[model samples]
Target: MTALTKNNPFAASVYVYDEEEYARMQMLVTEDVTAGVALKGDEVVSVFAHQDGAHPGVAQSMLRQATALGGRRLDCFDTVLPKLYADAGFVPVARLTWNDDYAPDGWNYETYRRYNNGRPDVVFMAYDPSAVGSLYERGAGKYVTDYDDGIAKTQAYQAASVGN
Candidate 1:
């Protein structure tokens, strides 16, 4: 894992993975790597940084690189980092309960609500529509169906919610 620290005190570590290897790992039916079946392609699995503030530039760079490597999208589950993802050209598409199987028990609905000031469950965001072309065929018409509408709605909601 190479850390991206271009003059930033808070450096983000990036991890690149062979898509087949990742898919195989995901299909783990046992505790053995060899037993897993490989899929195909390449992917940027993670880019993480610890800081007191958000780093949009770093996040954007990571997203760009992931897309360039054929990643369909970037997935982040951090409940407190939606703005960061948004600034990095991601749009919210769905929300999930904090108590989802993936999250720890400590992150239950009550805890999530209290800590997030009554915010909904985790927000799932996808990269910008403009970035979709890099991962799909041109004129394929297979891009995000609600890209434009979602962006407009989200922006309006944000503008209205700011300073509240």
Candidate 2:
């Protein structure tokens, strides 16, 4: 395991774990069995950061660490903040949806289901860590703002549909 620290109080630590260990750690955070399955070899690296640590600095740090470790790709299951991943050069490749019965704590499954008219959506993203530096240099702030806007929109939509 490798740890990256930032000055931000919210983002105290970001850890990049070896494939086998990462896989084991993921088991406790999610029901997705394939979280790091594609990153089993040395070509890809798996990373973890607390939801509160989902800031640009942490993301950039992780990207750099992954690149330094000789990772060709980086894979992670970001339950929220797809746009942040998008900014880091990660693209959404898959979406996993779960019913209310299986939804994780703090996730408003009913709202998500209502937004999709009964389909909840969770995003899985991938990216080449090597390309992230250039991407970040281009317009990192824009991506973070866009992600925040998306969250705000979702919250507004859900709040509006509270009693419907």
**TM-score for each prediction?**
0.40, 0.37
Cα lDDT tens digits, model 2, 32-148, are: 221221233433334444434325345445544443444333322233344455565554434444345544334433444433543434443445433353322212221222333
Q: Candidate 1: where are CA atoms >4 Å away?
A: 1-44, 52-57, 100-102, 105-114, 117-120, 131-164
Per residue, candidate 1 scores C-alpha lDDT tens digits across 38-154 of 112322244554342254334455545554544333333434445555554555554444334444323335444543443334444455544332322112111233334433443
What C-alpha lDDT, on a 0 to 100 scale, does residue 108 get in candidate 1? 36
Instruction: Give residue 70's error in model 1 in angstroms.
Output: 2.4
In the order shown, what is each candidate's alpha-carbon RMSD?
13.8, 14.8
Tell me how candidate 2 scores on lDDT: 0.37
Q: What lDDT score goes with residue 128 in model 2?
A: 42
For model 2, the stretches where C-alpha displacement exceeds 4 angstroms are: 1-56, 67-80, 106-120, 129-164
